[model samples]
Target: MTGKIRVVVAKPGLDGHDRGAKVIARALRDAGMEVIYTGLHQTAEQIVETAIQEDADVVGLSVLSGAHMTLVPKVARLLREQGVEDVLVLAGGTIPEEDHEELKREGVLAVFTPGATTTDIVAFIKSSVAGAAA
Candidate 1:
């Protein structure tokens, strides 16, 4: 808790809907984390680069395109490729329940589907990052 929890909220792939991503970004900022939002249509590489440039503690990806499987793992791989193993990778939006375990296996810390509240996301990131730092 010594420093602000920095997080990058991004929309990856061809997904154009950004209301959710923006909402989460604002919520994280209001919760005291430094939130950087990489706007719409970002590639996995771009998200990772922004995360690195921002020195983020977490990367929050919002994908409504049902391409979570493809995009999440790609971002995770890019993070690992960049030697950013400590950054928590989380995804939300229209994800099926069955894919949650698979995403976790691919190194995503948590997956948030629809109906997940802003408080839940914020708390999850805060506690998860704090625990990691501990």
Candidate 2:
């Protein structure tokens, strides 16, 4: 809580679409959070390891491969298995409204679907982290 909110922006599974991830990473950085982007095609294991190594407060995942149901929860489970209970997991890209509640139940703090603004995302991260610290 004393330092910048560190975030790991990752793309897991076979998804090659990275524009969204990059945009979010840049926005977070611009908003003063230290963001570590794990490039394209990362694995759940790699993401968790990165989060641990980076001492991240948040793990922001971007998936356009329609594997959100599979990959998102896998990352969440991996984080939990690694004893990362305090880290907030957020997802973006093509996720359906029907799956939102289920994803939250899986430990994802929030899901940003298509058309979610970068400004809103930044505000959410700031307010969410600050509120958690409170």
Candidate 3:
């Protein structure tokens, strides 16, 4: 909590769309959190590496290509494997309500659907990792 919160906004797999990811990244940065936006087409390893290297307090994965089940959890598992079990993992964009619980079980703390407000997302990150920033 002594330093600003850091978040890694990643677009994994072949998801060419990046507008949503960028929007969230800017929102987090605007909220006074350090955000690292991993551009389009990043693999799970790349995302986890960025999160580790950035010392991210949160990892936000935005997928519109129906690959949330594959991509999101992989990044989470890899992070945990690298001894990063504390990073708050979140998924958004085209993820169904049905998948939310399963994603949570798989290490994702939350999943934001299409209509989720930016304010809610920022608040969630802040509240979820109340004293994690360093």
Candidate 4:
């Protein structure tokens, strides 16, 4: 494992909006993690490929198009299919509270809602990677 966390922050499907994703990407990069923001309307395949190619430590999916159930898990599943197990998957943006557990079961490590702070996100990634190392 490297000292810096590599994060692939993706906006998947036809979401058509990217402000939140861009904000999070900026925050993650500013926090000293290597960030690859795969701009708007990326497919599950593209996202997974970026993660695999970048050897990303974390994948932050930003979805607001009500396709969370499908797109988010599809990325996770694709990663696993490609033999990616160490990456910590996380999601944010308009995800319903009720859907969190099912997302987690599908391989997402955590879900952040509208009010979740960047500090919390940075801390979570740091601790999660550190804990996984231990």
- My TM-score estimates for the predictions, one after another, are 0.97, 0.97, 0.95, 0.96
Tens digits of lDDT, candidate 2, 19-85: 9999999999999999999998888999999999999989999998889999999999999999988
Decide which is better by lDDT, 3 or 4. Answer: 4
Off by over 4 Å in 2: none
Mind giving the per-residue lDDT tens digits that candidate 4 earns over 30-111? 9999999999999999999999999898999999998999999999999999999999999998999999999999999999
Q: Estimate candidate 3's alpha-carbon lDDT, on a 0 to 1 scale.
A: 0.90
Candidate number that wins on lDDT, 2 or 3: 2
lDDT: the better of candidates 2 and 4: 2
Residue 48, candidate 2: C-alpha displacement in angstroms: 0.2
For each candidate in the order shown, give its overall lDDT on alpha carbons: 0.93, 0.94, 0.90, 0.93
Q: After superposition, how far is residue 95 of candidate 1 from its true place, in Å?
A: 0.4
- Candidate that scores best on lDDT: 2
lDDT by residue (1-134, candidate 1, tens digit) is 68899999999999998988998999999998898999999999999999999999999999999899999999999999989999999999999999999999999999888889999998899899989998
RMSD of each: 0.7, 0.8, 1.5, 0.9
